[model samples]
Target chain A: MNKTIINRLLVNRNNNHLFKRTYSSVGNKIPRDPKYAVINSKDIDYFRSILKDPNQILTDKDDVDPFNCDWMKKFKGNSQLVVKPKTTEQVSKILSYCNEKKIAVVPQGGNTGLVGGSVPVHDEIILSLANMSKVESFDPITGVVTVQAGCILENIENYLVPLGYTVPIDLGAKGSCQIGGNASTNAGGIRLLRYGSLHGSILGVEAVLADGTVLDCLSTLRKDNTGYDLKQLFIGSEGTLGVITKLSFITPPKPTSVNVALFSCHSFDRVQQVLIRAKKQLGDILSAFEFMDRPCIDLVLKHQAGTREPFDDSTPFYVLMETSGFNEVHDGEKLSSFLESIMGDELIVDGSVATDSKNMTSFWKLRETITESLGKEGATYKYDLSLPIDQFYQLVAVMREKLDGKALVYGFGHVGDGNLHLNISTPNQSYSKDMLDMIEPFVYEYTSKHRGSISAEHGIGAMKSQHLHFSKSDPAIHLMKSIKHAMDPNNILNPYKVLPQ
Target chain B: MKIFVPVKRVIDYAAKIRVRPDKSGVDTNGVRMSTNPFDEIAIEEAVRLKEKGIAKEVVAITMGPKASEEVLRSSLAIGADQGVIVNTDKPLNPLSVAKLLQKLAETEKPNLIIMGKQAIDDDCNQTAQMLAGLLKWPQATFASKIEISESKDSVKVTREIDGGLETLSMKLPAIISCDLRLNEPRYAKLANIMKAKKVQLTTKTPEDLGVQLNENLKIVSVEEPAKRSGGSKVTTVDDIVASLKKHSLI
Candidate 1:
């Protein structure tokens, strides 16, 4: 439980064999038939000789804390030992030896993740692959990039941008999220509306099984109807199956032009009307359509002062619209005329479009600041749901009406993907319980009634596990449990997480 | 003397895991994966050992699908000499993996083997012990410190214990499971990254090792851990004492 207890459990081994002198900082106290045996002196030199570079490896506790847990403050454990293996053979030997000794191993990538799936829930060893990030190969012709999983999403974008290719899927956490974790999580971000998902883009995956067996499914071929699509399992298996080391994804061609429009809506109805009208005219060019509630818009304006609103008039809702096309002049003109037509129909009261790149980013800030803005408001409760676009709004409206006096409610969504983000807030701290007990279930029931998903893009981490039943069926749950049992029989891989207790 | 260390890629040690409410296994969607931190330290130990001239070569090995090889390549960046991957899509247990590595050991014969004490994904601390049992070699679990003899035929290791550290002497070909306190792991320098690409890596299959991997261990269920409900805060220590007395604890 304490550091001393763990340290005492790992006494040193002294060997006089092969002409070795041993010295201890403490007195000449030798260890007994310790619970953990010390390796012979010769083995130390043997391991040292095999390493390509040992200077960079860290073994101290100070070096391990940063690597221990993830972004979500949920799963925690004591693995008094941490190791970084740089080669596949070293990983094999480590596994082989650990297998011989009955030690456990945990693989890690970019530690930025929501699920407690990455950290240890027990005193298991950890393996960090942060150093393994690199672009192994890239072929523009095939529109594929083979890279190590540890590579960050931002780095991948930078690497590919120069080659006129872009990783279609991106999120706010792109700067910190690693490609390996992205593949493992099957992450869906803002760009998912425009570019599908990893199930389509990720061509192959290379991962290590629980026992250190490297399964190489890193196929570059786009259409390989093999006996079984094993890569899909690990794509979102959360490392229960194995550690993903490399990924081969189909990078899409870069868009020639991008445009954005921010519109003020008197109500959610007008927002929907504008969406229907814009989609009809803009059609395939409409890449993103995001909605923001009044409270969220107020928070953004308050927090990020001087970020201009498109209109001087006040509105209860706002919509951030974006479109990407191959032709700049033609697409820009079409987008302008379409917005003008919608404004004439009273679907949009007031709005402004980004004329340049700087303005385009400024418009995006209005949308990206939702998470931060919600943080500014006290005690924020989040609900990310997916339902029929029309029903999604109705659910939020119903929750708002139900909680009119109980608490403050805000509702918005990514209309393009039918994902809704509803937040409940209270002026008083006491309302939090009322909000959770009374409001949370009501919102979930509404989503379920509409045949909606409890989780859309953000995964069902510890925060949303309790509501998983709202989205999944009994047979589906049964199959998932069977897979978990088959892969991790000892129930050690991220114990107490992912599966319902 | 060369050393080969095995590191399994697993969930990032920090990500929060959520068990599905509907009795499904953990919701893996958006769960992050990384190198098991303990294995990283093991790799650091090997790299330090080799840099200190205690050993000659360090090869990193991982047994999984192609994605697992990324961790091996990461080891290359961390200063591993090269790598050998036993590629398999089928999930295997500690015993089976040990069998495959035992076959590879017959050819490589690494002087020392090191790994993280356990993986973060499935915290089963069995692979190293099973490997040692299969190979009939002295096993050191949770080694905090390791000192090699000059001739490299023996090793002095410090094992973590419940009360204090215990030291032992063992002959050559020993398995040492690394603890967090072993050594500080290093990052791959920009210069070494290019070199890592040229590093030789031999990819093998279960067929190559002649080890048939049919999983033996079976899981009956994958349940989520109990959630810690939000508790009311106590105003002061005296109020806490009153609550304790009310509960008849002290």
Candidate 2:
């Protein structure tokens, strides 16, 4: 069957059932807003009146329960009602009514996030964009896709494949994540190396304020130097400022040929050298350059079934390299020569080139499965930080040495973009305050010492709000709070998030 | 030894299938179709056999509409040395598909044939068995694990049965159907997809293959399963017990 036609024929029936879990086993410490008005029969009546479709208003516990938890299942909210509106007009009316009633609301998308950002914190109303999942428009000649905030990243990717275009953002969570959520969080993914960041690709953003004011600045242009590009504010606002409803982005044409290669390196410095050489040799085709430690891959092999160690002898580090271009023959020859040179220079101890798509996908799984593998091990103290490539693993090594095996600390991420996913794990699978206390100030101090960012790709949702000060100065944080207050005076739009108390 | 693998085009595994309102059959109006997943496993196995040097060439053949040529190209991208497409717009039942395959086997005369136990859609699980029966060849179905014998004249396969696994040894020119646990099929890389364009795909018609085209089984009517109502949430343990009691469950 034609892939384009087939792609459109069947929707994924599995994810809905897969996401349902018995109300989280996580503790009930996250607080609900006291200021927000409780739901009376009148409020429910008003909500029902606004949404013509009664089915869109989910009051049933089983149906609305999944929206109350984050992807990691680390946080849970006791939200009573969830509303999914199909149109921006409906969203505007729902928010307008909620605002008039002084009811707190949590704007949600795919609800796939490392931090407790998408789900409700308390019994606030859950305003979902689930029904607003359509590609509003697409220009084949310009390669710009204007999609509703609720459109899934993976679905858009498949949709664009026939048009010879690709989604600018690519992540492990692409299958379930919403582009609106990604843009709202300024999601930096594997494609960051090739396509820059969401901040660059997203040309315009359309959001609804807490007061139901539509900030309609969604534009589809290559260049716009208009005053005060307000879209940037909502790009990483974390829904604390407003609810993102739609967005327009410039997408790149799909590459005709692709190549994936895995290299084993002895040290971080050697990995850096390999990356520099690959960029110079592969040039514009270099899509990703990621590295993981022995411990990380070991965890993956132990946790993810069917995933084996790519190399017989374990090296200190492994780097997964990806390249894509227009010509397969040229790209293959270019990559083969680069691999030969790297081997000749002894920069890499051993390497494996994905001979086929099967091997290539498995190789990607080795790199992509790191998070799930870590999850299987135990409670992971996660940190997405940006540091110099030369000394990226130094933080992980320092933490590991300092922790003295009380917890396992490992580092892995997009090394090309200097985004290090520093993970401190409790192998015993029990989270304790003492462990957190030991890791925080020390890790923050170390990151600051290196002049690095505390939060790289993953935004400062509920989890890292307090730690924002470690990365930003008091004035910068004060300005963010001021913006938050100005945009959402009631603090009802995802209250107690993105900003520290 | 040369391996012949027959694959079918079906709705992708990731797709959520919904019965059309009229219930004629599965509504494939907008869904993305790809090579049947089980067939992918068979293709993976054939390619692996060729890679292992036990098999010299792997030929992937599919019978369907012109669009099924995409499935053949995908097979080639998955490592098939060549692809053959039997073009026909008409739908073929399992028996019809088997007979057409049988005619192709008479002319191709491959040493062995490998295919999926069944296409996920329809899921008759009859094609491989019927083909083997018509050809009078040894057959192994529901194969989870496969091993090439030293003689290379026979294959050792572990079949996943309901109760337990059963091991079987089958001779040359045998028909083997793949189960889910056999092996994970590799993705079709862009480079391979490009290379697949260069692969020799010979197109033939079912009529030219000298096979009778007749679909004996007719689908009466198609209807979607009744939608389950959303469950209610209870505040406490007593509420749950009371609801269960009200539903006459516990």
On TM-score, the leading prediction is 2
TM for every model, in the order presented, reads 0.57, 0.70
Across A190-258, the per-residue lDDT of candidate 1 in tens digits comes to 777778888899999887665667789999999999799989988876666667888899998766566
- Tens-place lDDT per residue, model 2, B3-54, is 8999898876655577877777888864646688899899999999898889
RMSD of 1: 30.3
**Real interface contacts reproduced by model 2, as a fraction:** 0.02
Residue A89 alpha-carbon offset, candidate 1, angstroms: 4.4
Q: Which stretches of candidate 1 lie over 4 Å from their true place?
A: A1-62, A72-82, A88-107, A122-124, A376-379, A401-408, A425-435, A438-442, B1-250
Candidate 2, residue A197: the lDDT equals 90
What tens-digit string does per-residue lDDT give for candidate 2 at A325-358?
Answer: 8876698678867876887788988776654344
Each model's lDDT: 0.70, 0.82
TM-scores for chain B, listed for all candidates = 0.89, 0.93
The first chain of model 1 has a TM-score of 0.82
DockQ of each: 0.01, 0.06
